[model samples]
Target chain A: MSKEMTGAEMVIQALKDQGVDHLFGYPGGAVLPIYDALFQQNHIEHILVRHEQAALHSAEGYARSSGKVGVVLVTSGPGATNAVTGLADALMDSIPLVCISGQVATHLIGNDAFQECDTVGITRPCTKHNYLVRDINDLARILHEAFYVAQNGRPGPVVVDIPKDVQFAKGTYVGRENIEHKTYKPKLVGDNDKIQQAVEMISAAKRPIFYTGGGVINSGPAASRALRELARLTGVPVTSTLMGLGAFPAANSQWLGMLGMHGTYEANMTMHDCDVMVCIGARFDDRITGRLDAFSPGSKKIHIDIDPSSINKNVKVDLPIIGDCTKVLEALITTWKSQDRHIDRDALDAWWAQIGRWRARNSLAYRQVADVIKPQQAIERLYAATKDRDVYISTEVGQHQMWAAQFFRFEEPNRWMTSGGLGTMGYGLPAAIGAQIAHPDALCIDIAGEASIQMNIQEMATAIQFNLPVKVFILNNRYMGMVRQWQELLHGGRYSHSYSEALPDFVKLSEAYGGVGIRCEKPGDLDAAIQEMINVKRPVIFDCIVDQQENCFPMIPSGRAHNEMILGDMAIDLDAAISDEGKMLV
Target chain B: MSLAQEKTERHTLSVLVDNEPGVLARVIGLFSGRGYNIDSLTVSEVSQEGHLSRITIVTTGTPMVIEQIRNQLDRLVPVHRVRDLTVEAISLERELAMVKVRGTGEARSEALRLGEAFRARVIDATTESFVFEITGKSDKIDQFALLMQPLGLVEVSRTGTVAISRGPEAM
Candidate 1:
């Protein structure tokens, strides 16, 4: 059962045991031995990345899309360091990933040796767990333990730092069989008492809204359907965060849509003005709740999440029901049916009527001055163009990102992946590539902002190499939309350096990189550009030049109440309408 | 944004250690925050000062980095001294861990008595598990931890690792 081999051999065996088919990484000086062993391995296909960060992100894309453990390997120093941010991204998102780093020889370790850094020490905070392999024989088990740790419980990344000597050194490599990890089993089954209490609360509440987050997306399609059914049966409107975009269908009448700063004015107002806010698997992040004291001022919150620590970590909760989101939701449905709580049809109908009025009166607007391309209009067209397709949508953070979420009208769960918690800029393109690889048959596209798209533009090589047919929708505004909007609102129109006149020709850039590129300047041409992108059957980048001055409106600025919104060009117009929607305004 | 990465300063930090498992975790957990980055970290098991083992870690950073690292290392309950060797350049640091394995007969006995001569212990002695303990430099430990593979080296528990500055004065 044992043969003399290098630590690299043991690691490869460990990866195979963990059922890893594809991995992302690059070779370096401290990891030559690993590369040599890796060269001998035939089972795993390694993706060559332009940078180590891309390697980490590609793995993240894979994990987020497939609900599997993503793997990344890199050499010591900068290679290991570059992967940290991506590791942090995965950690924050609770995506399962295993990162392996090569180190200098054990003797040359701290002698100020070139490319020598303590990989385990550096990555500890960013990872669920890390290991520094001082012994070669421990490699197999360490790798095994790493995979187990990364995938178990509320999944996160794990790093295994293997030194050069260890990778080259001789050892008996035993392929891991029946791995035992007694310390880390998460509770999959829901507790009945809390479920019963939650059921009772839901049944009793007259005006209830579901605040859903990434947990809804991560829990899979079952959880989304469960949340929807609960909302339908209870006559409660469901509002989602950016991470929870596709958790509930936007087309569903029961769905109240996005809630927060860039969220629909009505959804935010409803969550603010509701009686009971049932938060399922969503944290009361700063984006959702502008100020906790002023947030949902009249609502009694019931927070249900798998992670116990996340229960009361943000806003105050009346009931902290801790367990799996889907499990607890199903349990609540069971308890709700048994209770047979009386329906308040008048109150439910009245809430919907008020919401409908708010949506039409104070919807996000960009002026249609004949030639101007409103971001929202572009997004609506984009959504309309891609409707009914089982495709994955990834977006860069900014005004277009918000608009995409608002307009996409997504039906399936886990189909929408964006930088929700971290709000990372260069997330979309790579994430689209990962999603495409995870589901080759399904369409994948990146709705990117101009500045954010440039951040990870190097990943275009990956798309080209694999001939991944991911369409890139670049919402070009020639400025950082989010920062520009903030400057305009808070800093009294001090635009500063937000506008960059010398913008790169995205069409030329895409062409140079061997992909189809189209420039759609007007709404009339948007369809043609989109059709051209779809026809490529390879990578395509559509540089859609949106109106530069157009901003995401109905915004509740920082340190302001949700009701105190600047709806469109007329400030406080949204507030006046929302407050006067019905007679029962608190 | 500290975009211009200042050149890493070489620092030698010495730690007086009880040499226990999970001690390393506490030492390492301090520097893994958002702003802090560690460079050139080393640990060893040098016990010239009686029962206490002194660990030396050579790291590089600006003055601010050194101070933070030292302060964090000092906070560890098991650590007695966390002197920055960058400031006090001359202090000795060495490590010792021996690898013991089980073979059929001659190889097995050779490993045993070598353990005896090195003051190593047969920590585990099942028909399969023949654990031996020896102390030396990290490289020596690593080399031995590796060399015993053909002779059945199953698992490893290293007191990873301790460091000290080179020489005459105390850190």
Candidate 2:
């Protein structure tokens, strides 16, 4: 038996049933009824944001930090259009979210009504899945299904578009237990034969490396623990992608820093020369596998992932185990123990010697100057000051982002959140806000670049309103650092519009939003500024002015193999020397 | 095969998707948005419980472009499976075409003779015209339409290629 209620009431009740305590949204004409229903209820709290786009990003920050499915509500037309970037961002990063958009009435659809657009059509590609509910009877079930699909499988964003008429109409409220999804069960346990094959390869290989990614964190804390135990038991060096940092402890001796375009020297060299590569949860993205033909050329690969299509989509593996990361890692551990798998000790010692030679390069080494603060040093000092506290870190894209990933050490899962796949610039502030909201007592900081922080600077108001102390540590270089570096290297020094002109002083900007601001321009003031920012009881912005012309290095130029990396000290000076062909390119 | 022969080949692809609203539009949008050409398209509910639909599309492209299309289709979350029926297995493909022709005297008799020869049935008829429903491979329908052009062919409407694997395996 089901009780009759208005669609708006059903929406509120469903959220309550799903254990959702908070939602981020902005009210509009189309969602007025739902907003009215929200007004009469106190069970699910709603956080009003300045813009709909910020609402979705706040939800993303909340979801990525708390490991919960974030929810948002917005109106149709521009409200829904504004969320396209966040939806695509969440989709690319596999962040689970259920975004509910209120559309125009069913009769007004396709009729060019005011405040109406093709919400379902526009969001279809961006969202993992979406629905347009036409009948009132289908409203309750669609909302429940939206959560089911968004949180299950490889997690991603899902949208449910509700019309204005449906909000006013009556519907039967069905609980979650009554809803059923057919033909959508994902395989959670891997094949036993495939696991056995992986164990055999692991026991025999001389130079073995473990490459892990965000999927381990997505699989939960158990997988992260298993990954650490496996690396210790096998005595194999481990490397990770940008999204996989917190999934394995950075302090562990077997850790080879990050592996990719901006990866450390030892990590990239090991990936290029390994005999057996065990990829646990990370896809072989282009950044990780530089030139396809030369990527891990001599390795027998083993890949474990939940998505079947992701298995052989880019790099083919000799053995494919399709299952959750924790389940598969547990099975591998069991199989190895039961078979008494062992490797040649003498061969393993030689492999470590070779790795030690690569480590001697000290790929992250940079000259520290007395006058100006280097971006790398700023992140290093920030890490040194916050290393002992319960902290969550988020970053905006560019050189500062890479430096943050290189310098900051993460020792636990789900503690670091950044825009990895899409590389969205304005991700850090709101993500910090969301993380701070989830864990009010923890120190949450966004390691941001000067230019990227301005993209979503309006979110400072949200933090101030909520009284959440999220530190925004901006590496102020006064230019789009990554773009300038690319222009210098690839465009023959004809710098485009990468420099930020007429930029407002961040100190004044923070005060304008009623928040604390601190500026540190010299190397001597760096540590004290970070400490001051951390001690502030309100929202604070720490602007650390750094070297403007410095470039991020250990970079494998586009379409080049990993071994052909250009170190920072070896980077060519574009201004001092120009080839005869450089004139033409300019 | 020679490189020239492999440059562009007509291939039939079968895609299984969730039976939900706007899914077909999403599939068709991928083709038009990317500027990829679609020669023919047919869609119908394939599951008896009414939760899944099969969309068969016939497009011509190089091997690389076809592979990209399949990968992109698979990336869509609602899409359950995508199979290149032409390359994956030996399969039978058929198209249904209704051809209308207006003729008189000897032309009319010749039209009837050709229709019988091709095993086409006259679904509608008048004294001077007949609408023949023909079902066969795409090339066969193309040949029949070409033959009817000389006998005063008026119009033609064709359902795109629908295909399935020949063996016991279900894709």
Candidate 3:
């Protein structure tokens, strides 16, 4: 049934077998043969991007929402290099991606010919696995292995670098009978002993809080409910990392917001206040614990992450569980027999009561006395408009990004995708295009910063070309808000060039790109703009120009403790202002 | 204006093929089937060559699918060796692309000044872009292309990249 074909043809055919619809990439020398072969295939559509970075992020967007492997193509040398950041981001966040790059002919490799680089070596650290195809016949197997590696183990990026000569070589397109992984295997089943120990720790603790991260999303809705049931049954408060926002209902009574710099004041404080912090899926990045020494000093840490390296990388853990969250939770629950009065009696209730007091007495306020629209309020409004619908929300980096992470909660897993670790700029727009392709029925949005959105504004053409429905809500503050906010607070307000003097009229730009453009300059026009975007069912860019001076508050300055927070409206010193606790932090 | 002005391009590649069952046999079968000539061929397992060896190959093609090889190789099984000798412009792509120009007369003198400004050179200059061998990044080649465009975009050749892990590391 299978005959001779080039590695290029086989790869394309394999992608076709997988039912891939759209691919994003740009061209170069070493990869010419593949392109030539690819020209004959019409089943898959390839979107040409301005930069390689955009290609990877776009693929990530496609994969995160669809639970499929997003594929990208780029030429050798610089093209492969540009995709590294996006690959690292996907690897850390566990998004499925398959990236392919061309190479110089194999003979002149180390001699450094026209467009050659050791791509497999370069991407090894970032990718779950990488394959360099010398033998054209092995092309089908390599792709199959790459996809299997990317989608199976914790879901990450995989690279397949083919040489120009190899691509043109005649190869047989015998499909991979099945995937066989050797090096990287993410364990989905937990050990009985470890599971029992985790449960015992949970049951014995006086004050316990479930601290989670993006891993919960990969666990899907079923496991999430299981974790929530465990929390509900035990009456423990729950919190999340920035990536873990939608893992649980944001409005639940025991919910204690996200934990990090710009984390909810109570969540960050709770991490410190609790006697036991059961961290799940999140590696305690520096942003989460500003000063590790002061981070949960009084707490006994139980760090549970699928990654063995992350087990004790950031925050030291007394009890470490290394495996997939769903598997681990299932094992723990199986070993855990339901108990009635196993609660630490008054100790647990008192902890919960204190968190309640923090909310009742000092509800982390971001409201302005003069009625200026707060970023949090904007997020709240977006969430209210969507109404727990299955929507894909992609965000650009900085303050607006943090705010969206802080609020605008979703219910489904893989519904939210952002550049979590690498913070690649110009990620939002292209990613939205990819997301729209994966989830045509659900609303797809890019919550963008003015600076970050411009990074991939050209992708508007890709959206228009495909007639994909992608709504872009530009949180236009006319500044690099996150960097600017840091300058305002930590650097004594010494202004930098974060101010953009030649900011484009985004609405006009969107219109120029063959999409509907909606501008919301005031709160009154917000709903109409959102409605217009939803109704269009095509790409729409909404320029929501907000106050230029606002900052994302409840910030834990770098190298500071959770308790040391600079709340919003810090121009008026909280020391001089009345404190509900009747004590000044200063 | 002239066909000669377009210059010539050469490419080298290293392929990582799987040394398993009939994987390499099938891949070699593909190459011979298509009648594509490989300039050079080298195979050794960078990671357990007995089980998974890499095959380094060299061949030349027009700009058309210089981008397609790796895309194709990535689809192969056991074929682990496929890296572009030229993948700089996209990754840290630049600071890795070297400019080689040839020149003479006013063209050569002007090329030197311009190359110096862009931090380029006369690594081998007879009379063109000075064979102005400027090695820095992929962007440098683009800048060199522009500068040479006026000074005579003459004959240009570039070595894609010989990049390694940034830290004291190897990949």
Candidate 4:
């Protein structure tokens, strides 16, 4: 039913109709009407953020954890401009977010009026789609369309810019059920012939590996289930991109760990030597496919993805299935079940033996010195402390993020959130807050580096005000660890401004924000400190001092092949370890 | 050999997109943002009732890059369809150019003669100048412009290129 209402009221009504229960935003002069309308409503709770960037990141975390479209509201000019980074981040990582920004009055748009900037123009490249509502009649329709566009196939951020005058103008509000998109349908089912071809390749191959990515998680729980079924049924080992961490259970015997620059030895080796590579949901990003000329040279690759653009964009595949991961995996399982002949048992056994040898390297191992806590050890202890609870983890981009990916095991999809594609440093704290808001009683933590946490430290006040028990476990290494590591290896250790000099005592900072703070310097106190941080009923910043000189290992150096990874100090000489067959394949 | 080392080839892509504000900017932005080449482009509203516009873009890339271009164009939310006219079918490519020659004597007559030889029409004329409008393949327009250069060619304005498939199918 259509009813007459002011444009601002329609904004709230449209969101309510779309089932949005929360909004992350900061108020400004231009959005007064929308704020006034919001104040009148009790259905949608607004979490006021300190910075507009935090608002967007929080929405992204909420969306990633809850598997729903995250909503954000902001005012004109800088408010919209501040959201650009998060928009770009969401676009790169395929997170679904809808941002509504107030524009200057329609007449004053080009007059350089107060608090005015071209929101749609600036966000065009970063967002999946955007709209600027000139007429009040288009307001409700565009709001509903923004939500639809954000959460659909190959989901990404969408922006709707509403002029202040348009917000005040009276218009007829149309519910979502009355609106229909004519040209935005995405393909969800794969072609049967191509799926059959994929199944045939899987059954005939010996050294087969499934390289999964965020698409499996994005496809929802059903896709993860289908993936587990397919892996078990075909006896194929599985490795994932950092974004795909929890889609396949970490505890499963067939899991080969994450595959990329900082991936495990066995995972990267399997990617290089596998005869049949079934890549589902993950685009072969540059990080994943090192030295593209030498990547998986001998493999018959099959790529399954929902976006047609993702296929053949990086690594070309023999079979390209354009469909949702869940649908395609289901088809593969059914087709493989019907085939009388399966994988060659003898060749499979030999392949498993080679993988076992690679696993024996223990690429993730790092010596724990008695005097100090290694970052990896800190993450392992944190994982141990919270693994039994209803937990969601987010991370800032740094060495700590890598350690969390390597050591903190995820058993379910959506339990881990990080800025994978853009690698934004300030993503974690706000994201943890967003996740905490989504699942009120769940244990939410931001695995952060000291340098990365400082980027969005102001959000601690927001967490305290909202009563979110989000924990920020800071691995205090006193350096921009990733940059320091790179400088040491590639730039002759210049260090150049990589040090975290003039750092705030995170404990005091947390206390200043009216929250609890815990500091642990000794390795022996790590577990108890993590437990204390977890048990805190309010926002807490756990400052865990770790080894300052540690470097993330098992790294495929930039421009190097996947097979040419530099393992940790404990690893044996890899050149002598590779078999003659592996040498020939390389 | 790596796919990147392969020789690049020119391809013409016809894209149907929603005829709305900033839609063209979105299409152009994709090319510039991704570092993809755009040799020439022409766009206009094709269906008034359907609110659709057709954009014809000429780009040069390797086979893989060309495939990437098609897929990326198709991925745009406003884009309805993307058809590679160069490879999909026997297609016709044409461009419209208006050439102005500013000579009073033989150069003006020569420019007019060449324009007629290329099926050009005299759209405008003055005592000291003549403007000839011509429509043909992009190469034909290029050749006509080249010939007019020596004939005191003052200026030339050209619509880049527009193409259509030869078959009865609709893109």
Highest DockQ against the true fold, candidate? 4
**Model-by-model DockQ, in order:** 0.04, 0.28, 0.01, 0.79
Which candidate achieves the best lDDT against the true structure?
4
Residue-level lDDT for A332 in candidate 3: 65
Please, what are the lDDT tens digits per residue for candidate 3 over residues A209-254? 8998888777666668777777777788888887777777876788
Over the stretch A456-494, how does candidate 4's per-residue lDDT look in tens digits? 999998998899999999999999999898767665668
TM-score of chain A of 2: 0.97
Candidate 2 docking DockQ: 0.28
Report lDDT (Cα) of residue A323, candidate 1. 72
Tens-digit per-residue lDDT, A1-586, candidate 1: 5678778777787788789988888889987877787799799877777778878877877888787788888999999999888888887887889999999889987787999887776786677777788888778877887887787656788888888889888888766675665334566667777777777777777777888887877776788889887877788888888877788887888777788877788888888888888888887887788755688888888988776556555466788886777888888787777778644888878878888887776566667756877888888887877786778888878887888887788887778877776677888888888788788888899999888888889889888988788888988989998778766655566888877567789989888999888889877777777777777788888899888888787677666668866677784433234332221311
Residue-wise lDDT of candidate 2 within A388-443, one digit each (tens)? 99999999999999999999999998889899999989989988887888889999
Ranking by TM-score: 4, 2, 1, 3
iRMSD (Å), candidate 2? 5.1
Model 3 per-residue lDDT tens digits across residues B42-104? 454456635666554455554323334443344343444355654532222233234554556
Higher TM-score: candidate 1 or 2? 2
Tell me which residue pairs clash in candidate 2. none
Give the residue spans of candidate 4 off by over 4 A: A570-586
State candidate 4's TM-score.
0.97
- Minimum summed lDDT over a 10-residue window in model 2 chain A is located at A577-586
lDDT per residue (tens digit) for residues B48-133 in model 2: 68589999999988775677678667767678889999999898899999999999999999999999999999999999999999
